[model samples]
Target: MSSDPRIRLSGVEHTFEGRSGRVQALDRIDLTIEPGEFVSVVGASGCGKTTLLRLIAGFVHASTGTVEVDGECGVVFQRPSLYPWLSVAGNVEFGLKMRRVPRKERRETARRYLDLVGLGEFADAAPYELSGGMQQRCQIARVLATEPPTVLMDEPFGALDALTRENLQAELRRIAKERTVLFVTHSVEEAVLLSTRVLVMSPRPGKIVLDLPIETDPAQDLDTLRTSPAVLAATEKVRDHVQRRTPLRQA
Candidate 1:
């Protein structure tokens, strides 16, 4: 893997032309994600959490400041954007195909990621055949098959049921063990559970309000982690910071 910072944003600010006027979505954003760090971004709706993720993913360019990424980047959105015509294996190999990888290697690479995400048995199945959580899992496998050094996630589990969300969180904790991840989510507990560092953002023209380092045992099972006193206390603390900035309706 490369030695450079996986992601770096310096004095970054983004503005878009709105119906009323130019609206700034992010302001003076400065962040650096080292290789192998899991960073979670939390904010109220309209606070530019998605915008930040998109900026790092290179979907939208920042109006000001430099955003640098040292290696390949992949994104998994809240909604799975799978190809219905393709089978599970095909979907996972799509990026490799785009990169002109040979068919034999593509199939092998796809199988590895599918199995990593616990969907090896569903290789030949259609995307529609899987549940919402399972479909999202396939999306993750597709991104991972590309062997990206950085993964940007826009609340990939936001739409799942509570149980499925928890299960996938555990799966993600395992999959991103070595890569750099920038995750945006509304759930405080989810952020606390999966992140090495958690960032809280302001209401509008979003800026980092708090950047907290989380220290927890990753070896612990999900059930144990959820019930641990330290985890609960950290969850509450992060929740309090968010509640103070986010509107009650959003909270």
Candidate 2:
């Protein structure tokens, strides 16, 4: 892993004007993501994990402080959001096309990433023809095709069944071995399985409650790792922190 910080957030805050009043979504957030690091953000619902992702993606501006993303970033949301009319390879090349990459280079890069995600054979397939898992793989290929130094994922596999989610989680772990990834998810198991560092956020006005390092071997199988004592201990620590911050009514 590189020693330099790939992304930095200092005193980041955001609020929205709701019918009731102004509601704070994030507060005083300070984070640093290092090059080639895999970090997971976990918290209860409404903790602004997605908001933080949007801020980093440049979709939304920070309300209070600075968000400095040094390298290019690719984002994947909960849904694949692939265009049905586009072939798998076409979809993967969409970003490159938008950036006006040469057609030859676009096709070459698209094929490389599709193969990387085990979708090379599906290059000509349409989104509708794919299973949920396959479509997510295409989406990942699309993101990887951008060749960004950092990837931001917001609950990318949250909608999948347990089996599919587990499968993709393993694939994601493999991908993270080659790139910097910042993923947000509510699943404690997913966080423990894929993260180098897990950031636990507090509820409402989200803040980092704990930034815990995950020390297990990154090469361990997801199933075996989840059952390990170290993984269980980390999960419990995160669960306790989130529970302490959650209101009794919600708990």
Q: Best candidate, lDDT-wise? A: 1
lDDT of 2 by residue, 1-251 (tens): 45679999999999989899999999899899889889999899998999999999999999899999987899998999998889999999999999999999999999998887888999999899999989998999998888889999999998899888888888888876768899999998788779989988888899888888889986678889988999999889878877777432211
Root-mean-square deviation (CA) per prediction: 3.2, 3.2
- List runs of model 2 lying over 4 Å from the truth: 1-3, 246-251
TM-score of each: 0.95, 0.93
The sequence of per-residue lDDT tens digits that candidate 1 reaches over residues 25-56 is 99889898899999999978999999999999
lDDT of each: 0.91, 0.88
Model 2 TM-score, all chains together: 0.93
Poorly placed runs, candidate 1 (over 4 Å) = 246-251
The positional error of residue 83 in candidate 2, measured at the CA in angstroms, is 1.7
- Candidate 1: pairs in clash: none
